[model samples]
Target: MSHTFSLSRVARLVGVPRSTLQRMVKEGRLTAQNGEVEMEELLRVFPDVKWEDDGEYARVEEIKKKAFAKRIFERALPDKEVLADRLFDLTHEYATAKGLLAHYEQLFEWVMHKLDDVAEAGGAPAAQAVADCKLWLRQQLAAAPREAERARGLLAEERAMRIVSVQVKVLPSGHEFFVEGSDTILEAALRAGIPLNYGCSNGNCGECRARLVAGEVKKVHPHDYVLKEADKAQGAFLMCSYTAVSDIVIEAAVAGAQDIPHQVIATRVKAVELLDERLAALHLTTPRSQRLRFLAGQRVRLKADGVEGEYYLASCPCEDRHLELHVRRDNRPFARRVFDGLRKEDPVTVEGPEGSLVINLDSRRPVIFVAWDDGFAPIKSLVQHAMSLELAEHMHLYWVAADLGHYQDNLCRSWADALDNFTYVPLWVDGGAPEVAARILDDHPDLSHTDLYAAGPAQFLQHLRDGAMARGLSPRGWHAEVLA
Candidate 1:
């Protein structure tokens, strides 16, 4: 048996920054005694446990790494998302028996023994790692009648012949859907395209709130952000807030669905060789068989296999068949792949043409598009699409890049020649352009009334929003993309 450690020691076992580990304690995100936290509590949050001195932890991690490599080598899966990695991570944390840590460890271990080697636990693939966890769980499960039935019910072998229907409704949109999972609604929704809006979907964000119209639901995780007495009276609930004790009908206010276009398809890519290193100007084609319809400046989700992530569309109606995706390699999961390993003809999927980040072309006053770096993707598509309709003329794009060579000459020179009304301004953000926005305001003092389409990091996007708002621009008149 191993000795329990303090919060500081457990924090080291988990990769969370010390500050966040501390917050988890203060916020009661995890339970602790005095200044000490169980290694097991830490494990429940993070599955891949590492002991400061235990050889077992390293051995398990190395084994997981090898399994991951083998999966990728066989092309069975792509890279894991930052959050998804955390799922399997929890499978490795262990606690001493009979303590608060016992149940978490036992439950995790029981799950490991009954599944295949390639199965995903919760949501991440950690079948082999989970298998190692079964020993202790099996013994305790035999003594706990109720939980034993619940755990066994989740496995196919445990109940392969049974089938059930589950209904779900998307909030705000009210777009209703259905699914059948071996376990919970959260798992089912993820399998379906609709993910419940959540931060730490473990019920921390209060972001996953929904209405439980009828039937029963149980809180699986200890969520203190319970529905207020008033809201609960009205039938609203948090999807991650509960597990259905009985078939449940609930409503959750889903995010990410405003003015989002329909049927976004993506294919093809163009390598902007002159752009920054590992930077590629991907010429994304809508479904090759059909034309993808989206606003010039909206975004879409890029999916490869079962894993999906999002990107903005850089093409417009005029460029109907061809879309553009400006991708840069910065070591983010699926994104890094598109920039580095993915190529033309590689099959990919696209979801809702999303986001409301575009100029109201009807405003019609030689609009200005301000973008930084790859943020130019949607702007280029919008400009191209708008010029074709004459709804846009005398359009000016002011872009800030690391340097001048970051842009392709054909893309620039062609816009100048083809659309006499279209203009381009490229600034070097790194070469001491004190403030690109300030430079633009200085050059075009008439900035007082120019309609702008801005997209970039939260800081840059907010900078434009604040400056424009401060200059007396109505909030509706100035548009910026919401990336967070």
Candidate 2:
């Protein structure tokens, strides 16, 4: 029988993004049956792929390691029980295949004996014909197919992948991520930049309960929140406490910006990075059990040394306990404190992740992000979020540097260099709002199919909105926040 793999598994085995595979299917360049791709079809579609080389997969893993520092790979391997279960499943499959091979061998022997009997009864002509047929069958069986080596490599790689990490698909929202190492479903989801609804991440509040639609799960952490017997029978489990043992489908909730609740987390000053003489990046780390939950592009109120100020988060939510804020050397209380003397390990209170200018997770259109001066803080967060999601068809970033002087210019350039779909343009704030807006808008004459996110002064945003609308951008496609 031919092997068939799910889209997620196929993407991993081929070292490509799931979105790329989906697009190929949509464009008729590839074929899939019921969301699974046959092994023959996969080989036909990607003939040049060197299945033995895992460069692409390794690159993605390194990127994830940098992005999700502590939450990723707490252990080098999965839990022992989960590993055993996976091994058991693989062994069962091997045994079944071995049994089938034995059965086929017995059938071949029986066929040979019947041919001999027919030859003995029918005489010399019939015996010669039977001998020729048996010789052809033996030759065909002995000759290896052209794809045999590549197919063997692919199967070996996929089996290794299955043992190391399991793919997960969330229902309703259709978001997919992989559970690697010893990560629970909730942890993996958050690391992927997906906001799954939960209260206490330790599984006391029961908010992380989800139903298993398919596959197996192993409980790695004990939860105080108890499920009813009926619920257990229905495959209900806490996402924060269970790790997947195989590729799984789950019915769970994906949160939007509004779905996240306000949180007051007592965080410590991890470091103070001086980007320029006029700007500083304050790094804060929350307690292990009480990580602040917020979407990208949101502003938080930070209080330190009896003073507080509101600033936009410059870090992606996927960064686990680490939170980053860009503080300009202004008269604001927190900015003054950060510039003056915010040492490492100092106490800081973070509260109210208040802002609606978040990424639209559902949109797959090309994105244009415009940031003015220090407004790049939120824009940077949004850009990282978009990168983690990998949902945008293309991304264009235009930074109109004013006082901050493109402090993170290298970072932007690195993003552009790393991603084929990303582009970065740094501009000087020479003329006023209209002139700058016109200059940026001049690049794209047609904005109807694009999503534009701009963070700047109110006047600049107004000019940008008016110009973009005039250039066929729908009102729904335009999103802006006044940073001034």
Candidate 3:
């Protein structure tokens, strides 16, 4: 027999939010039917969710049924082997036996006192024996949280202890969190509704690296050179595996970002030019009344149906009446929206100019503009903005693109020549491979110490970040116009 089920049911079966499931659908990451999400898909995220098709609410009912079954089976068919194995792991990991022993004692107590309730005829004695062991194990388990501190001479310490809450100034996109029973800062932030920079929670991957500003913490678990002791002293540490005994403040710089004021304004696709079979230059125009004050390199999101994106603006900001974006012809079902369904004069909606790629008209800092691929958007903006401010000579530009031809038909060169003080360096990632950075460095090592600006996809921007950091560049001296 076969059955069909709704993904809504599947989402309910798991403890995750519906937004996560919806995102999966939008990204085409997880396959689902109109009213049917497969059991296999549900189990991928939660190994415990099961099916109960006896009713219309199959997955929901299934979750309750499964959890009930789990409780029942745990009591009925208690696994001494699994318990013993867990005991071994806990004993190896922690110096104290109380935690592991408490669980063991609980099981032991349940087995001896409640054996008859769980047993089937002759099984009563065996279950009772397990419970007896639990009572004996209880002797080894530590006292409760309240009592244990007294035994450790902490009761007197608590009498003198004063609790002070201080507000640490977290960055506009940074946050804080604490580790209980320990003073080690964790590798991830504790924001309620945001994704922290985390990779492996096992302390092996250093994905949640950040810097501490106030408060102190100690390491709880071992880390694999994710952060050196010296680095920690220098305000760098991992958040994933660290425990914060104190209310320490840390900053990831890009985390905890909040959405700013935004609105979708009517914009028209003004022109579309075929640079090549694989590339396109798209121009969009807003009504003269609705002037889009976007930077040359800033992008506005275009939404159709429900899909929206951070498409870079190719037109200089000086032309506030019109906007332009250059899109690579990615051969995908979604890509067809722009490459096929989209027309030169099609009505489009745009919402943004929300980024840090604009001209800092007040800053006297020299700018080193680096654009990888379609990242040329912001550099062009910076160039034009510099021209407007008559600070063009202070602006330096480097364009690194995957396809050199993409820059050919876009009329990018004419803008480059017209924009004073905007020097262009066009190099493909593969054309001059290994020495790309080296040659550029040789030509301009001043990037080693300048206000560097880079814009591109997450990976490209990350690469630039890593390279710049390796070359003794300070974070304050570096800026990025990243789109992900």
- Tell me, by lDDT, which candidate is best: 2
User: Which candidate do you rate higher for TM-score, 1 or 2?
Assistant: 2
Q: Write the per-residue lDDT of candidate 2 for residues 209-270, one digit (tens) a residue.
A: 99999999989999999899999999999999999999999999988778889999999999
TM-score, candidate 2, is 0.93
* Tens-digit lDDT string for candidate 3 (271-359): 77776676666777777545554444556677654556567766555453556676777754334677886886777788875665655
**Displacement of the residue 41 alpha carbon in candidate 1, Å:** 82
- Tens-digit lDDT track of model 1 for 1-484: 3234444234324433233444566667877775556544544565443323334333433432331221111112212331233233333322322455678777665656455444554445465455555545566665776533433332222112112333454444443333333334664454333434554456666766777777655554567775678887887666654545433457664434442336645555433232557566566555534655456677777787555667776654434255566666666666667655676577677777767775463454557777777777777656654443334335777777752243554565456544445677877775343366666666555555567787666766666666666665666667777543
> Which ranking of candidates, highest TM-score first?
2, 1, 3
Candidate 2's displacement at residue 149, Å, is 1.9
Runs in model 2 deviating more than 4 A are: 33-35, 60-75, 114-129
Query: Which whole-number lDDT from 0 to 100 does residue 393 have in model 2?
Result: 75
